[model samples]
Target: MDIADLTPAERRVWEAFPLGEGVDFREGADDDPAAGASWGPERTVRAEVLRALLLGGPVRDDGIAGLKLWGARITGRLDLKYGTVEHSIRLRSCHFEGAPDLYGARIVALVLNDSVLPGLTAGNLRSEGVVRITCCRIRGPVRLAGAKISSGFFANGARLGSPDETPEEPVLQLNHAEVSTDVWAVGLTVHGQVRMNGATVGGQVNIENAVLSAPGGTALHAETLVVGTDLNARGIHARGRVNLSGARIPRHLSLTRSRLSNPDELALRISSCVIGELWLQEAARIEGTVNFRRAQVDLLHVPPEVWPEHVRIDGLSYRVLAPHRSAEQRLPLLERETEGYLPYSYEQLTAAYRTLGDDAAARTVQLAKLRRHRRTLPRYARLWGYVQDAAVGYGFRPMRAGGWLLLLLCTGTLAFALHHPPALKPSEAPGFNPLFYTLDLLLPIIDFGQESAFAPHGWYQWLSYLLIATGWVLATTIAAGITRSLNRQ
Candidate 1:
């Protein structure tokens, strides 16, 4: 790695490494590949030459030794696997002949901004400072699996994946990576999956305005991802499912204005996830089913209409629902739960309305729950349910009982007044009032003296028997409904 043996581009990079100054070689080079067919050896530098300088080569110790080359055509693989570099490396607008293999390497910082590469193999990489791959074009997967970065990882506006159809392979993989700070991938475009399963981020994971398309497979699979603060994916358009199952985001999980299009399959899966605030705003559109099974959210900011036709919310719990609506409006959401007859879903909806201090709406939800439960009952049980519903509205409507009682009283009073019953014994009987006589027949538990003294015959006797039967049925149904309401409270 002698300075005399270095090429012209390598010599410039070597001379500029001591003071951490950058060398620019893009003065007359064409940006388009077809037009730049004659990039000669003067603009080319061997990867080993750069690697030798980084590994304490014959450079003067001015205390600012680093590599900051710009627009150089790097030849051969920049293989630094299992190696250590104390200085930061910044290669901007460079074209790598092969992917730089930094597997199990330790470096201070690595910035490959605006670079074009075949792929990257930096799995198990330990970087003390930031790893910035901003605005780059990568033809294959960028693997950072099991990487531990102390600072942050930024890949804003990067286009990743091969032109050949391989949707099953991940374009960007950060599985099990641990980042101390944020992961900013704003406006990123990925042709295959962006898999970050089991990755842990200390700060936010912002992928706003990102476009991911893997039509038959998952677009983004961040299952079991742990984010300390927020996961902001606002305005992201994903063609396949975005699965965040078992993810834990303590602060916010925002998907505002995002479009998830996996029409036949699940568009989004937050199953078993625990989020602080889940924001699925009005503008967000999901073409397929969304599963929130076993997920817990502190605050859910989703409109009723924002939900797709199919949503599985079994065991899903949320403390508060934003922009609250009446129970009538929100009750339909519970019905969208794919699992039929899940009482927990209905109860959760009722509690949400109660938290808003809408007691009437809460009662309405309870009544609806009873009706839904009725559909699963046998024919005989359903008949009893119909009686209870008509008599007392399952205790949700208390006034209905009173109305029925008044109607029965009026029918009996008029019938008895028109045809008075004969007394059992004239000497023992007192002159009977029509209202008291009717009350005696209608009230099975209460005994007015006139009921024992008088004796009805023919049609009058049949009317009395009907009234007694009606009284027992009404009393039983009313008592049952009241007991159910109390139990619910």
Candidate 2:
């Protein structure tokens, strides 16, 4: 593979393409700095010649092996429409005169580190290796719709912006793209929306420390994305909504210390997602509602005190609420939700506590939920709810029945002592005490012969019957509550 063996067209393009002072492409080239350098120095290359070499070039191994164009400005639009580039295009600190159109092109790999581009239109691109564009600055939008990258898409520290700054237009669009590895955009900044809707990533999507601003619109629209690993966006500052609805991430979706501010609408919509772990702790400030409706996760870790007040947790099921915190501490956090009582919310929480093997805590949540349900009932039913609550707390607090019984006994004894009712039958005892008479009237099943002997007149007779009925209701409630508790045990 000598330069003399190149075709006339290829030989002319290769001669015009500038290689630095220390690069050589003779036959049997080795990794010796004295023989030649792996990367070239700063120089400009005609876009057509560079394209010719990339499309059909004869090198030592028929690949761009020792070609590293540093500070090289490529002139004209490097269009590779439907062409297959077989070499790794590694350009560092290069400047493009126009946007390189790789539309419908298949390439081995692409690395444009520390470069400046007007814009990129690489729609329907197919790459076998990484697409590394680290620390680059693009003045216009980057369109990669329907692209397929076998390895990662690394764009760390890149700054992207659109010409119109429109909220509807995305600065970096990767819609329906498939990446075999991660999409690393750590510390990246974008002026408009970064849309990755319907994309599939085999590894994590790390956007940590990124600044994304699309005010009054979606900053990061990743709806229906399927990430095999975690989607770590910790320390992100987003001015608009960060939507991940219908996404499925098997590992975790963390937003720790992220600041999302879309005060008018939903700042984050994670509804209908299936995630393994969801982390929104460490003072993650979300100004608007974070809807988690119908989302299922194995664990949800959030600081209770710092949780956003505007959250919709309906049908959001989690096996554990805060595994790192105590049950008593986590219960108040769920109770502080501003989204009012949804019965399923409490039910999910009860199931989570039950999974933790804390049935008492689960029952407490169920009791609280029952009280919430009672509040929504009709007035007649509400009165019955009050009776049930006072007696046994919907069978969760059986000790309350003993407190009611003591209160009844004290009141009955005081009433009988104040006004003594005459006995219908003659008493053989010399001193007739009212305490025994009141006990007989209060207890429904037990009789000491005093209730039959004592006859109250007018209102007193009515009061005695009322007391007996009240005692019977309370006794039945207490017995039922005790039976339920025993059965649960």
Candidate 3:
């Protein structure tokens, strides 16, 4: 690394490496990488020279030590695979001809903010400090699989994907990576899928206001992810499925005001996840099915109208639901399960209503459950179910049974009052009263003396038989309804 052998651009970097000084080659604020096309070789630095200097290649002893260059044109690949850098590296507003490869490298800190790069490969990389790539416009995939970051990974406002937007692989992937702190990717715009499967984040993963578009494929795939805190993706606009299946977030997962539209497919798949609180309020519009199958959430803040047309809640368990609504308003949510007639879902809805101390709503949900269950029964059994429903509202509405009984009594009284029955035996006959006679016939196991004293004749006998049969049927239905209700409890 002799000064005489160094080129003009290399000489500046060599001179500044000892003291960790920054060199800005741009003439103005708008002098981006595209504007560097007109710049001469004086602003170009070979990647090997920087690599040599970073690996302790004959530098004068100075107090500070880091690489901070801006607006420079990097000529070759900055390959630092399996190497250890003792100092920070900041390459802001720079243009790289090749993607930087830092696979299996251990670096103190790294910053490539506001740079236009082809791509980056930092798989298995271990960084002790923050790795910031904010506002960068990368035209290729950025892989950080198996990486371990101590501070955090910030990629705010970064645009990742190819120019043609037909990436065969994920645009940004950090599978199995461990971040001790937050992963701040707010306002990120990714054209392809962003995968973070099996990753563990000790802090929040804030991707609010981000735009993710992968029409036919998944937009965000974070399966088996474990977030120690909230995953705030509020106001995000995703055109494909945002799958968080098997994730465990111990805090809130806010999707408030987000717009997800993957028609005829899954819009948001959080199946098998264990989340603390899930916020889908503020008119979050989800077009496709939201599968919450087997997910256990502590608190849910989804409005009734925010439910998508299709949902899969086969094993969804939640402790609390916001905006406590009546069964009439919330029962439709359980009805929206694509796989119809899951008794567990109905029971879950009933339990949720009961948790809110709305016993009336809970009973209504149970009644609806019986009605739904009846649809799957045999025709004859369904007819019996209809009888029970009409008689006692399946034991949910006991007052209806009383109303029916009163109506039958009135009908019997009117018919018998107009035409009284003759006494069977004149010597032992009591006084004739049509009301008492009707009561005697209607009461199944009761006698009022008038029924036995005055025996009905002609059509009057047939009317008495009808009344007696009606009374027995009512008694049987009421008893069956009571038993069914007790069993449910």
lDDT tens readout by residue for model 1, 1-489: 668898877888888888888898886555532222256787888999988988875556665888997777888999999999988999988888889999999999999988888899999999999999998988888999999999999999999985476844688999999999999999999999999999999999999999999886899999999998999999999999899999999999999888889997999999999999999885465789999999999999898878888899999998888778777888887777778888998898888877887778888999999999999999999999998888788777866876787798898899889988999998989997778887887777788787898989998899889888877766666676678668768
Model 3, which residues run further than 4 Å from truth? 57-62, 423-430, 440-453, 457-459, 465-489
How does candidate 1 score on lDDT? 0.87
Candidate 2 per-residue lDDT, tens place, 139-252, comes to 788989899999999999998985356744688989999999999999999989899999999999999999999888899999999998999998999999989999999998
- Total clashes for model 1: 0
Question: In candidate 2, how many clashes are counted?
Answer: 0
- Write down the TM-score of every candidate: 0.90, 0.83, 0.92
lDDT of 3 at 187: 99
Off by over 4 Å in 2: 1-42, 61-66, 162-164, 323-341, 357-364, 378-395, 423-433, 443-449, 484-489
Model 2: what TM-score? 0.83
lDDT of 3 by residue, 1-489 (tens): 577888988898887888888888877888878555466788899888888878775445655788989999898899999999987899999988889999999999989999989899999999999999899988899999999999999999999995476898999988999999999999999999999999999999999999999997899999999998999999999989999999999999999989998999999999999999999888566888899999999888888988888899999988887878778988888788899989998888888877887778888999999999999999999999999888778878876766777788898799888987888998889888888888788777778898889878898899899888877767666666678667657
* Model 2 global lDDT (CA atoms, 0 to 1): 0.78
Candidate 1 vs candidate 2: the TM-score winner is 1
lDDT of 3 at 26: 78
User: Which window of ten consecutive residues has the lowest lDDT sum in model 1?
Assistant: 28-37
